[model samples]
Target: MKESTGQTIMIQGEQTGILDADTVLITGNVSVPAGGTLTFLPGTTILTTGFFGINVEGTLLAEGTINSKLVFSVADTSGFYNLYDSRGGWNGINFLSTDQAGDSSIFSHCTFYYGKAFGDSINKMGGALNIRNFSKIRISDCEFKHNKAIFWGGAVFAEESDLKITNTEFSDNFCGTPGPPYGYGGAACFRYSDADLTGCRFYGNSSTGIGGAVSCEYSDVLITTGVFQDNFSGLGGALGYLRSNPDRPVSCNLFTGNSSLFFGGAISCNRANPSFINNTITENHSVSYGGGFYCNDSAAPVLINTILYGNYAPEGQQVYIWDVNSSPSFYYCNVQGDSAAFGGTGGIGFNSPYLYNTDTLPLFSGIYPSPFTLSDNSPCINAGNPDTTGLMLPETDLAGNIRIVGNVIDQGCYENQSGLTATGRVNKELQILCYPNPFRENVTFILPGEYHGNCSINITDMSGKMVFSSSSMKGNSFNWNVVTDKTTGLNPGFYCVSISAGKVNGSALILHVE
Candidate 1:
């Protein structure tokens, strides 16, 4: 491997044909020239032999289709592309420095797999990249599997950059230090940056300290229609946020399912105040407190039309809002769980949750596999705020479906309908759903198609009471607020959500409150 100090290299510009080499290696550090394009033809496989691989400084636009997918992996003297052999070798590719002006670098339809690491810092670098300070960067249709980083970010470590990520799958990435002061993240880590992630799936990863799936620190992230399941971390199981700043802590975008350790088993926000609306946070367990959420000394999270079910810890469980100064508010929010009530604690296991509305009990009656179904006559059906804005809801869910329908707002990320199934399921069909049932606190619903037009969604409670609602819907989702009391009002009962168009027919639902 020859070393090059310069930062400009042109690969196949006026030249075409396949540049097939035994090892397409980068010696020292190489960068593409300004406004230059490096194109990789079909059936192009590049191999490197350094601590780091090809580092792109300028713009990189590598587009590969299904049949002729681009591959970035290790090389042996025997010319074998071993998938499971990580005998302390090398990183696949590295993109260090990017162009300042016109910072729109994109990587699409690529597969980064089977990278490894050893100790401290970052051992085997990026499976595909490690970028910094770039704008409008897009990575889509990519698969990062069986990649390992010693410290953080299994597939990619994007820092101090504004990026848009979509349709990416990160699986089987491990980042766990067994000894003292352990730290690791199975997936990506965002620090001091702004990013929007959509249609991404994070599953089957393990970490030691925090954030097995994703970690956000001192940054603003918006996640829409993403799935986080079966990921494990010591502190925050699926997602973790550790922001030092009191006023402007790191905030992650809305949508659902972030299981954690002490607080927010599905999603945990330590000192952050990210908007959380219309998400399903369930089935998360904590060893001590906050089966679903554990907040302390932080700003009160704004929850609208979201569902919290089957989340459990020990003793005092569910949402534990302790030491948080700001009073948190929940409008048409549903919290359903079971309590064994040890040590004469009683039936309720939820600790003190800062309330805007005082209905803190689970509204419906039933058990898992079918708890808050509309057919079961659950109170969560239509209990929502009628005054939520379009800015609160997402443009679409993970499968690119719209979020709002008629004037009705469904609960959680996926709209509950009579017959709808979750993504990545074998029998993609639902048995029961919830809609326009009578809401009191908040209303949640799913959209029909991709929401591309402007719309508004609202909510109200029983006895013709209007509590929360909103307009300015920019996308397909909606979370209507109906909580009237900021501190301690709202008797446990039922609620409703009403949706509308530009002078068109509306819809409604009834929700059960406990």
Candidate 2:
């Protein structure tokens, strides 16, 4: 099954059905044989020649949805030019093989611009594309502009691979190639592989010497719902995690950002213990060390509910959790600017770690006499950590509802919940008023009256079985003895009567039968 010379071969180089060539004009160096299924409809346009354009190995179903798209630019047939003049022109899709493992290949809703990378190094121009080693790729909602991987992954160069990127976009990828010892990730470069990024977005990339956007060694990433902006890495504008062995545990996968970088800008866990959650790291910019984050030495990162605003490395400010053995811990967090560090590099607390609820976590609403302005009752408003029930929350923010009740789940990535209202916050309204509302079995639980005394009456049966539980039900009233028939008989449905009284806990609405 090897016959794909170029210039057009839909069913000719087929493996199944309809792929009648929407535009397959690969002018040089081509080879896509191995049970291929390369489909590219929806306003299609494919043209490659700078060096190595589309070389899949087999099974490449170029998917396109979200409003017609599957363009791989670079052939204007003169027509007066100017698609940005066709930029560098080649190197944006290469899934080679020496038997590089298996897994359905797909490049969804495609869009890669001015591609060029494959030699002078940067892994090849910004390393436009070269994912060897046991491939299993799936790049989603793609978009990479001004491609340049002179070496690295200005676009992508994953080795020993198994990648899955979503909602993609890696901006201004640069790095003119320089590895060996010079620096790291000008845009993206990983070794000893295992990547899994989600909801991706890395902006304004730049890496003169070190990871301007990303560079992971002994790799292991699992980033989620992303946004790494204004990237610049002399060290780690957005990422730079390295690890040889300290018990060997270098693993990344989570980082939160809303307004993105200016320095170690959004992340720099140079030792690795990655698992940062809920991000909205703001206003980044560096001067000396880390402007937004810079966890060094024994990198320990497990920060949950993140939000650090107005970041700046003003003469060495913000973060610099150095000295290894790093035990970075912060729950339901939110830290404001100005982390002192003059002749005495000490900002955001150097050593002596272990801190909890930092002043209940930035809960200020007023404190600006001169230029200290912090108007709208600051305390970062509504403060976060609604206790985070079972964790894993983020269904919709960035303006998409369903995040949490009252829309109050702020700490980053936006979720103001608009006109949020909970009024008389406490008083849970008699803990949620319910006087046997619709009860049957000799029901009685009227504890509102400002609720008092000993109480603990549970009667769950919505599958949460616990048919009944009583604890000396004293005060307001409590009585339920409809044992229905010894051990099983009542067949009426709906049942949940949780009553706590003392620290207030209420729930009622029952129905029983026999």
Candidate 3:
């Protein structure tokens, strides 16, 4: 070890202990022995000169702050694109099966870039963070970018380990080679492991194989409130869930703008029965089938209060099943097409036994720039299951709003705080006009001055249960404060109101109250 005047150290062999300086260079293989710990201070930088790796058979604690992040990278990868092996430089931390003290290991507010994995079959995995055996690890608030692996995970690979990652960002990572099952998971892969990811974002990652961003096989994973966008692959454009399903369902996520060369523009489920709830899948493209999702080999994903729209494919615009063994079920969802529009083998059909789903425009604020907030006239508001008992939804949606704002959860990822019910734009054909259509406490009904005091006003809930019934007192304009007036037993929801005042036009109006 050679220490410079500025406290920068150069390590040519194994290393351990605390690295509190601003710069540390690894010129050769480095290993932290078992029962040992390698700690990095805030703003510490670890730079690898060759294809060397920082082998961690013990524990690594890199706890940096938001203002001071620990960085692991190569010094220069200037002309790396011309050479396949040099594109992604340096070997990342190899948490081998021999590791024992890694269970309590934590890495937070760190940045990993330009990591690569390629050699024998055993070494060609996990470009950035590789783990094996029964060890458990926690990685939070980390950024991984421009990493590559010949097989398995481009940024991270884990087998038989419990990996908990939260609030991380993965971008521009890729699988170096595209092939069969081996070349998968452009960003991350897990096999026979148990993992939990929360509030993660994956975009601009790709593989010529299965998952463009993430792939899992024989692993149980619970991912909540994730965002996957603009990734592409041959099969699953964003995620490939293969033979993996955790106890808790993957909920309140957003999958958008992903494309596939073949099937499942957003997600592909193969022999995996993952439960998805309150997710928004939209604007994905597939050349053949299942623009939003593709399921095969006994895969049956249960969807609740999910929204799928604007997906493009030649056959199944939203979803496609390879055969009858796979049947995706939707409950209280907002789908753009009906059952007849779903496609599969031999004229097979999709199964969605629940009711109260709208098959029209959800009226989003916009398609891109995230959030995709709901407009006032959107039918998705208050469109979820009335009872939020066993739903197991996240407390917050993608936009950080309360998941269930009104009587029920919103249909998509965003909860509209403004409107709680679906009431289309008021009709001009009706002579009777109401101000503050989605009123909080009260609303005013204005007649055309031709109705009498006996004008009938009836209000019923969506289930056709009469909630309020009254006649016009004596004026052309009647203001009713439903909250204060005990005579009006009004509840918050969509109400169908019919007014018959002589011949003032016979029409039913849809009104909403919050």
Candidate 4:
């Protein structure tokens, strides 16, 4: 150990006690022995060279203030222009312990960047931070970016650990070696662990396989008020869960603009059962199936008050299920397509025995980071499951608004604070007039004076089958000339004419004579 007042000190071997306002340069691997504690003060910068890493078997406390942050960066940038060139620049910090209650590590207001963990072909795991063997760790207000791992987690990897990560941001991280299941998570990966992530943001991450942002196997994860956006992978662009507990839920989260090559543009579950609540999954594209969500091999995910829309795929644009054993449940969700798009032989739709879902349009404000705000006349407002017996709901929405604006909760991650009831319409008092009660020539529709804007008219039979539809109505009135249909002519019958102008919808009955 070489200590200097203002210059860099080469640190190796066992380090204990306090390191305040120091610039430590690591050229070789360092370790903290058992019962030892290494504490860093604010404004401390540790630059590593020669693939050096800090291994801790005791405790590490790196607590920095908002104004002063602890930075972990590479010492050499001679050939480092991109992630590939910076590979093996420095190994990351590793915490190893078998005692669950004894291990305690905390990192706050820290920045970890340009770390590369390419642990031989066998144990390639975390790129920036690794917690192994029942270690308990807490990370808060940290930033992890530009990290690369040859396999597994690009930023963090936890095995059999209990981790709590809050107010963190992970971006531009990557994992994989260009093939197969070797690449798991671009930001973080967990195995047989318990993780709780709150108020975190993961963006612009990519993986060659599995989860682009996060992946879990045999783990219990509860993610709340998190944002995952613009992540890419072969499966599960935002999150992938395998054999995870169903009771461990992901609530009040936003997943948008994620893309996958095979399945689950936003989320994928394989042999896993997890609950998703109050999540906005939109604008994600899948090349094969399940643009918004995917389930296979007995994966059963319960979706409650979630919004899935504007996703694109060849089949199951909103949700896709491959195995017949996979039974996904939907409650008070706003899905994109009809029952056919929800896959599986099980019942699907609003009236289906297994679903309280709807195909109503969820008018999102825009893409990711846009809050997914509901319009004033959106049907999703106040349309949520009334029973909140055992559900875990966040106290506030993504925008920090009250989760429930009115009596009932709103669907999706955002709750509108407009205080508008579900029964409120755009124009409740607008009147609709239909002329020619019993005519064979033509019929005309007139709108109220207060109504202005383009309106659509649809004539449906008594059996709820739409026979005639017109959107060309202009200036409040439209004349429909009854013409003989080339296939089936209009017979003497009663029909309902529904007119929609702005946010107001009204219907009028008309009669046709032979």
lDDT, candidates in the order shown? 0.53, 0.55, 0.76, 0.78
Model 2 global lDDT (CA atoms, 0 to 1): 0.55
Hey, what RMSD does candidate 1 come out at?
A: 15.1
**Best by the lDDT measure:** 4
Question: Any runs in candidate 1 off by more than 4 Å, and if so which?
Answer: 1-35, 49-51, 76-89, 117-128, 179-181, 244-263, 297-299, 322-328, 337-379, 398-401, 417-514
Q: Could you tell me the TM-score of candidate 4?
A: 0.80
Q: What 10-residue stretch in candidate 4 is worst by lDDT?
A: 344-353
Best by TM-score: 4
Give candidate 3's root-mean-square deviation (CA, Å). 12.3
Q: State the lDDT at 81 in candidate 1.
A: 24
lDDT of 1 by residue, 1-514 (tens): 1122323232322222223432244333344566665555443454444434455555665566666555555544221223233443345444455567744666677777656543334443333456566655788888777766656676666778768888888887765456544444668777776877777888876566667787777777776666777777766677776672322211112222344555556555667666566666665655556656555445455666776654556533456555535334556666543222211121233233424332233222222333333322233333445555554455554334555443555555544343332223312211112343334555456554544466665545434455554677555565544443341255544344444544432333334343
**lDDT-based ranking:** 4, 3, 2, 1
Please give the lDDT score at residue 251 for candidate 4.
94
Give candidate 4 misplaced runs (Cα > 4 Å). Answer: 1-7, 77-88, 98-103, 121-123, 343-353, 366-371, 426-514
RMSD of each: 15.1, 18.1, 12.3, 10.9
